[model samples]
Every structure is written in structure tokens, then in C-alpha cells.
Target: MDTGFFAPLLTGYEWQLSLYAAVGIAAVTLIGKYLVLLIPAFRAEHARNAAMRRSKMTKPHYAQNQRWNRRWGPVFLIAIFVGVLPFCLTAGSQPWWQMLLDIAAILLVYDFFYYLVHRFLFHDGGLLGGPLMWVHAVHHRQHNPCRQDSSYIHPIEVALGLGLYAGTIFGLSRVLGDFHVVTVVLTWVAFSQINLHNHDLWETDRFPFRYLATMSRMHHNHHARFTGGNFATITLLYDWLFGTLDHGHGYGKTKVAIRARSDASGIKKPPAEAGG
Candidate 1:
């Protein structure tokens, strides 16, 4: 409790305020991201994407999608992070040191289940039929996802995804006693922000092994050409442990597939990107 500079001052309502604050921060950052289209580079991307659309080269970046998602994303973000979420965190119940444990525990626990859902339900989980995978297919339509594409998910998938997060917090509160409000809010912010970063157009292969940038591309690849592995977000521990940590080598033919993807798409995969 009262971990942040102003959290101590809020007292009884700290958890609720933290929830609202998290929503505000996420909302502002996301809206600001949309404004990046005004930038010259991103504006050029808009033009290229328009051409791609004219030629029907891609369907993931539809104008209707951005319109709807921009309007609805914040609403759902608020609903999940603020409205549906309860003020369940206890007041000064856990020590400050436990906050770290709370963050790690929630992330690990959540990512474990996320890995399962992402691999099994989202990617068919090797079930051959993958009936439920269609709910996730809307997201995978983009091999090279843009930042706006992060929230551009089918509503059903959004429910399942956000539900898992909310369910984790509720479960942790019930099983482990209410966690610190600031901890949960901060964790959510990190989760949301990183989830967006995962969809960015950054070329991370230039970075060293296990670097944050590399890890972001690892997630990007999960949504892109290598839809099978890298199921975990925030950490690769689950992917690595479960043998699903696909970063090119984690899945398919290396040089051949790389060249094929390059040749087919005309977007050359940097040499370092071949194996990520």
C-alpha cells in the first residue's frame, strides 16, 4: 500500500485511485501513439499502407479497424482496468518488499496460462483442428503488425484475453490475499505498454541476445511468420521451459524460409533476423 509518491496520501481509496490512474496512463499513452501518424516517417507509412490497401496486398490495417479500435479500445481498457476490476487490494496489508513478489507472481502465473491459451486455443495447440483458434486468427492476419494493431482484435478474443488478466488479479486476491494496489496498477501498465511494444515495427535483431528489443521482436514473430511459438509475454521463461520459444530457430527452416519470406514479401529479412 501507498507505494507511490501520492499513494500514501490517498489512504483508503488508494487502490481505486490506482486503478483509475492506470486507465488514464494507458489511455493517454495509447492516444499519443495514434498521434504518431502525424510524424513524417509514420505519415509515409500511412501512404505505403494506403497503397498496399489499394492493391489488396494486405487486410490487417483496414481504416475501419483503426476507427473502431481507437474508439472502443479506451472504453474497454477502462471497463477492464477500472469498471470490471474491483477495489480488492488490501490496505497496507502487505509489506513493501512483498510488492516485488506480487508483481513477479502475477506475471508468471498469468503468463503461464497465457502461454497455454496462446499456444493451444490461439494456435491450435497442435490439436490439428484448432477449433477455437479462429477467435485468435483475427490478430494473426498481420504478419508485420503495427502499433495500432495491438488492440485490433476480435471482441471475443479481447474478452478472453482481458478476462484472463482480470481473473488472475481476482484469483490472486482470493488465494494470496489482496495485493498492493500500486503493484497491480504498475504491473498492468507494464503489461499494456509492453504488449504495444511487441506489435511495433522495430527491428530488434540488431540487439544482443535476450535484450528487451530482441524480446519484443520475439513476440512480434510470434504473431508474424512464426505463429507457433513465443507464447509468453513479459518473459520467455515459459516459452523456453515448454520448448515453444520459437524465434525462427524455435520453429522452421532457417535460411530457406527466411529467403522465401523475403522473396515472397519483397521485404528482406535482415541476416540477424533469420534466427532472431
Candidate 2:
């Protein structure tokens, strides 16, 4: 394939091209993540699971959180689009093969740095005071998060997280001097899809993308009882390298650990495993 085969497609209208790409990414991600719900068997299974989970709930359940996520999700997506726009417009000129390589490197770097930011800065309450903690707390509220919950984050969290990510990518582009915009856009889409898949409540046992099942499982554990570990959103490389990868006690079953904050005491409990 010619390196510049698609160059003309994005030659003049960089911002508009980026916007269109973002829209396409959103469309594909939504359809891919929730497409399983269209399958009769999978839909029935999800329904049964939802029913069983609701039956044992002591508080408002999935539907409530899902609705809340849906309400605020578009705002979060717009924030992401704004955050990514600069990088997309400033993408460097590079050969297609080299651009692909750069994209892979950027993704790996983003994953590592994000794991650090997520675990130490966002989740570790001792490091920062009230406001920052509150940002991440919104995400943890829905332990059994649905697809919409993927982007259902506080604006502060979105600003910090995506800001850091975009800043890093731009910095790397400047240093390398040939990081293409197409690479950045592709990586952004992948990043968004992976986060969505991680938060999706659907079982992935028979999914065509079986390789991503590990990520799905690790993220589930992160939401379940092993919140302290498995902080990486896209890949387990950082978590595994740092010894924070907790696969949990059970493989197939959900660990019933609720992260609750006590209003009066201002202290939180360690995730306690609930009996199955």
C-alpha cells in the first residue's frame, strides 16, 4: 500500500476530518459494545443476570446508574473531542508504516502513564484531598457498570486524565517530529473502545474478539473486590510489571465487594467480599 494513499482525504479539512473520525469512532464503539444485546441468547442471559443482581440489591441497581450515565455521557464525549482536537490537527507527517509503529508506542506509553495517574493520583485518596477524590469516586459508584458508565466520569477527572494523555502524545510528537495525525486518531478510537469494553457488564466468553477478554476480566476484578490492583484500563502490562495485577479469588464468578464511603467518619472501608 502507498504510504500516502489516504493523504488527500485529510489534506485540507483537518478539523472536519477529525470530527468525522470521532463521530465514526463513537458509532462503531456503541454498536460493537452493545451489539451482543441484540442476540436473543445473550440478551436473555443479561436479563437473567440483571434480575438476579437486582433481587439481591440493597440500593438502587444497574438501571439507575445506567440512566444516570446516559444523561451525562454526551457531555463527557464532547469533552474528549475537545481534548483530542489539538493533537489531531497538529499530527506530524510520517510514512504509514512508521505512523503505525508510532501509534503502538504511544498507546503503550499512554497505558503506563495512565496506570500511574489512575492509581496514585486518582484512586489513592491519601495523596490528594477532597476534590480529586470526589472525581474518581463517581466512577467507582457503579461497581457493575454498563456501557454508558465507561464515559460517565466527573468533568474534573476527564480534564485531568485526558489532558495528561493528550499532553503526553503531543510532547512525544514534538520530540519525534513525524507522528502522524491519523495515528493519533486511530489510537484515540482504540483507547475509547477499550475503556468502553472494560466497563461493559456483558460476558465475553463467546465474543469474536476473544483476546480482549482478559482485559474485560481484569477490569471486572478492578471493579469488584480487587480495586487496589488492576488499575490499567487498556492493558495489564503495567499492572503485571508492578505486581498490582490481582486476578481475584474466583475466575468466573463476580466478587461482591462494595466500596462505600462513610459520611460521618470520613473514612472508607477496604473492599469486603460479599458472600455468593
Candidate with top lDDT is 1
lDDT of 2 by residue, 142-170 (tens): 56555555655665676676777777676
> Where is the poorest 10-residue window by lDDT in model 2?
250-259
lDDT of 1 by residue, 109-181 (tens): 8888988878777775675556667777777776666665676677777777788987888788778876666
Which RMSD values do the candidates have, in order?
A: 8.5, 9.1
Tell me how far candidate 2 lies from the true structure as C-alpha RMSD in angstroms: 9.1
Off by over 4 Å in 1: 1-61, 81-84, 204-210, 250-276
Error of 2 at 151 (Å): 2.5
How displaced is residue 59 in candidate 2, in Å? 9.2
TM-scores for all candidates?
0.68, 0.64
Predict model 2's lDDT versus the native: 0.62
